[model samples]
Target chain A: MKAVEVKHLYFRYSREWILEDVSLELEDKEFLAIIGPNGGGKTTFLRILLGFLKPTKGEVKIYNKPPNKASYLIGYVPQYTTFSTDIPIVVEDIVLQGRLRKGKFFYTKEDKKIAYEKMEILGILHLKDKKIKNLSGGERQKVLIARALSVEPKILIMDEPTSAIDIKGQNEILNLIESLELTRIVVSHDVKILFRKVDKIAYINKRAIIHEAPQLNIPKDRHFCEVELIDFLKGEECGI
Target chain B: MWDLINTSIYAGILLSIAIGIIGSLIVVNKATSITGSIAHGSFGGIGIGLYLGVSVIVSTLFFTILLAIVLGVVSLYFQDRKDSLIGVIWALGMSVGIIFLNLTSGYQADALSYLFGNILLVGDSDLKFMAITDLVLIFSIVFLYNRFLAMSYDIEFLRLRGINVSLLYFYFLILTSITIVMSVRAIGIILILALFTIPPLIAEKFTKKFYQTIILSSIIAFIFIASGILISYYYDLSPTPIIVLIASFGLFLSMLKRS
Candidate 1:
């Protein structure tokens, strides 16, 4: 089943055309990366898909329903820096935000168990009591990912998951998302950030350029703009 | 100084804490200035209540919510530009209040207590109302703490997860209105705006997270009220302004130190 669908979507933020005639779709369990330069409407595209942005023209559907209605089925971990970490929240509480899909503040026993299980999976169960401000960047990202996963949505979308983190944190997050079982669509300028894990790359500068199963055996010399190709990367690790 | 610190001063101290806690929450939630507008606009409710010969507290409770929700919804509807619109409502509300105060027969200046708060003058009934409002604020936050946090930190993420962020946003406005209505006594109509703003402004100097900001600001508010109560009682000054000014001073000092 296709988890995300956008057709002729056009969005303008106060006179700036962010997404123009952008249409794309992803089947269930597909890992897609949206690569673009800064301000190329990557965030805007994510917002439109999440129904946070109203397109001036076109339609967006997630899980067979309209974006807004179908949003509950979508999990999101927006850029971690968007929120201040100095909040006194614990990892457990942060993760619980993911369970928002369940639609209640007070969690049931089963909910509590599930939250803890997610925490354990993220390897931060022991940090449940620590304040968010005290955590390292990588740990914070993990906690955020755990929170997004708490809803157990079929489709997970992240915006710039590896942008500001150190190399180790970047690798951890890249590996973590790669290991996840859900369908994933991540946006990043760092092409190689998700290349190791993602099955395909949708090169988006102004428009999306799709590349199928870019494994090591693929003959990249055959297609794509020369300048668009990176210095060196092969197979699933596409132009790294 | 020792003799000035009496029983009433002690009561002032406790109320001051309440001020800071509420102030901090207001700042973190970006409801400070809006709450200020609501506090000022509430005079309209106070005026209508007085004119109608109804219980002022009841009127305030009802009107604040209606008005605050209106303010919240208006801002949210306008995509959070209700600040300018709220300014219009504030001025209009005050104008209406002044007109009603003048036209009403019994008490023209009797509404002075609401204009500039008298913390030392907070009666038992006012205290009771404050207590209830405090409890509600605490309860709502405790119950929906995670929801509120998620909404505050990452509203889009919450919306994506289908958390109904809009409803929660309104829920915050409702709680803010109720808090404003309750604390109308200590902060007065004029200085209540400060009580909703200054302490949090100061607290943010020391704390990063929303809850810490609330705690620190509450502590500061408590101190200011306690000191203001003593100073007001001895020097015969208006306690609300004094307390709010103290908080302002604290905020200034904190900012200075950070700078």
Candidate 2:
């Protein structure tokens, strides 16, 4: 069974259509990069897969179950813009929230150990005691990644993981995400950063088209630019 | 003097405990405006209690909780219009209270006491009610600390974790409403927001964690409450205004030091 399966998904916000006839499937442990322009329904597609929204038409299945039922197995790193740094929360406490269970008032020793283990894996264990607001953008991203991983999810999804950081921070985040041993799905606007790392690229406008990276015949030494890549994808859609 | 001192002390302890726990949630969740509305809107309940010959505290508790839930539901359904909705509720509540107070038989000599608290008027029953409120606030905070913290930071993330975010938020507002109403007897409806916000602001400066902020803010609240009571006793003034002034001064000093 595929790790994720979507067939003829359509989403509309009131009178306008946001996503139409979008469909894709992912194998176990595959890395899929979703690239699109701003407001091209990239984030909306991820939200649908995360069960934050339901498709207007068609169905989505994760590991043979609906997205909502399989949500526990899916680790999600929402866009950093959604986080509020004004709250007085430490790194450990924020990460420990991922382990929250119904009727559990206190964080058990096992829960703490798991949180620390995830932080250690993400190389952020040293920053566990630090305030979330005091961390740099890159450090905060890593902490968020550690928090997501603390759930022990089989699939990991990140929305715009590198959008708010500097170039070096972006590269570092992408490299870190590439090294993780889970089925990874990321939505990004920059295609160049993902070109060499992702197994497949799904170019999404209002629709989505999946292209296996190895079959594209793009030279490894060639530097890909965002404008060119966007045009290239648009041309592909036009079959020119 | 001895009776007055005892009353102030009891009121101080209860106020400090509620402000410490619920105050942190208020500041973190940024619910001060909604809390302010609840505090002011509670006057309507007091007016109803007076008109119906019911206990003011009990009636106010019911009224405040109902108002808080209404605000919560409105904000949940209409996110952008919450501020305007709160404004309408804020005005309507005070207006309703005035209408009810005017309709009640005879003149209420102590009606102004509810608007600006008169700690000297606090009887033994009021103290008992305040004590019970403090217990409920403390128990709820202790039992649901993790969930509360999670909800405050990110309600969406908490919901995605399979936690019932709406139910948690409703209970949070209920606790906040209780805190606001209970404090009204000591600090008055007009000045209670100072106590709810100032200590948490100062505590946020001193502590690195949410729980630490709660503990530190409670201690700060105690100091202000105690000092306010003593100052009012020495000068023969209203304790609510004095307490709010002290808290405001502390906040000013903290800001000066930060710059």
Q: Using TM-score as the measure, which candidate wins? A: 2
Give per-residue CA lDDT, model 1, range A165-216, as digits (tens): 9998788888888898898989887856534756766665555555664553
TM-score of each: 0.81, 0.96
Candidate 2 residue spans exceeding 4 A from truth: A236-240
**B18-93 in candidate 1: lDDT tens per residue?**
5655565566666666777778888988887788878877887787787777787777788566668888877877
State model 2's lDDT: 0.85
Whole-model lDDT per candidate: 0.73, 0.85
Give the DockQ of candidate 2: 0.74
How does residue B67 of candidate 2 score in lDDT?
Answer: 95
* lDDT tens readout by residue for model 2, B92-155: 7888788999999999965688888866667787788788888998889888888888888878
DockQ for every model, please: 0.42, 0.74
For candidate 1, list the clashing residue pairs, or say none: A86-B209, A87-B209, A215-A235, A216-A235, B16-B221, B16-B222, B17-B222, B20-B218, B21-B218, B117-B188
